[model samples]
Target: MRYEATRSRVEDYFDRTATKTWERLTSDAPVSKIRETVRQGRDQMRERLLARLPSDLTGRRILDAGCGTGMVTEIMAARGAEVVAVDISPQLVEIARSRLTPGLAARVTFHAGDMLSADLGRFDHVLAMDSLIYYHAHDIRNALSVLGERTQENIVFTVAPRTPLLMMMWNAGKLFPRADRSPTMIPHAPKSLSRELEDIGTLADLGRVSKGFYISQALEFRV
Candidate 1:
């Protein structure tokens, strides 16, 4: 249950900060501003992830794993995709459901649970977003393997960068234990992540987004 503790911590953190987290991801403002910069970085990362998906999602089945507030889930559902949105935080899941239009709501199913163990069936595409940041390397591999099993086509996700500068900052942030309540930032290298996905029969396409204290690498794994 090593991951269980991290999962519980993440769930509690998101539950406590769900509204602020949603604004930080969905807001639009000048990037020169510190808060806006972080928001824009997350928005950019999401845009880059969506870019790898099919332009027309009509009838496609997608699993929005760790779908905090349903941002991606709503977008995909609006495009006519049937989406299964799962999150560890019940609070976030409730918020996500509330944000959906009635029509969009019908197209999406919301589940509160760990993506790695969710019995949700297969999908044409699986999106993990920034969810994997809670996991260490071995747990990440396990999660990716589970995602691979459930995905028929692609899996797109984001992870903190493993570079020395970023790692130093990540470690420094840990010195302030309050930040520890936030998701455990287990930074990941693209090369290492790619090898992990390869073992699951997927090839990775990697991209980076940096803003404020957030620097993440987005990986799109094609099956």
Candidate 2:
């Protein structure tokens, strides 16, 4: 119930309230100082996650779970991976599809739905960047388990690490007018998350990126 509620809130925010803002933030358009830092951090984190995958991804199948705006989708497809990019927001998914390069578009499929849906089929590698940050630990574990069951190799994901800076930012976000806030990010301690996910796979730390208000820790679940 909690997960469903959060999912609804997330979909609403991205699909209705902040579609234009997100489209701008993820693009070359100018943004505020804090958002610029976030953009930089997200770019760095995407690179970090990609580095963990095979350099030659020819013929590989990858799931870009919660692939907002499809930045990572285009990159993986360019490397010859069949990319399944899914996001909860149809508006974001449409934006992602519109931005796909000519040839690369053939290698990528865009969907607006639950990333963990069985109908999406299996994958060689799954990358869920900043996608699981809003869920509680138990929900996160369940999500990993569902993804892990169908992923043959690796499931790389990011979480909002429990840090003072992030906590402060989270609290500050709550003070915004209720109608203006996005879904609240739930921070997780690495040790606790590992414990929750131990049965799902062999967990490994892929490192973290903390730039200004954007802080996310990458973890790889080796199945």
Best by TM-score: 2
Q: Where in model 2 is the C-alpha error above 4 Å?
A: 171-180
**Residue 75 C-alpha lDDT in model 2:** 93
Per-model C-alpha RMSD = 2.5, 1.4
What does candidate 1's lDDT look like per residue over 1-223, in tens digits? Answer: 8788888888888877655656445634233466676776777888889888898999899999889888899899998899999998887888788878887877999999978764788889988889988688788777777777778888888888888887787788777767544565888888887776676666565678887756789987765
Give the per-residue Cα lDDT of candidate 1 at 59.
83
Worst 10 residues of 1 by lDDT: 23-32
Residue pairs of candidate 2 with colliding backbone atoms: none
Over the full model, what C-alpha lDDT does candidate 1 score relative to the true structure? Answer: 0.80
lDDT of 2 by residue, 1-223 (tens): 9889889999998999989999999999999999999999999999999998999899999999999999999999999999999999999999999999988988998899999899899999999999999999989888988888898899899999989888888889988997788899998888888888777677888888989867899998875
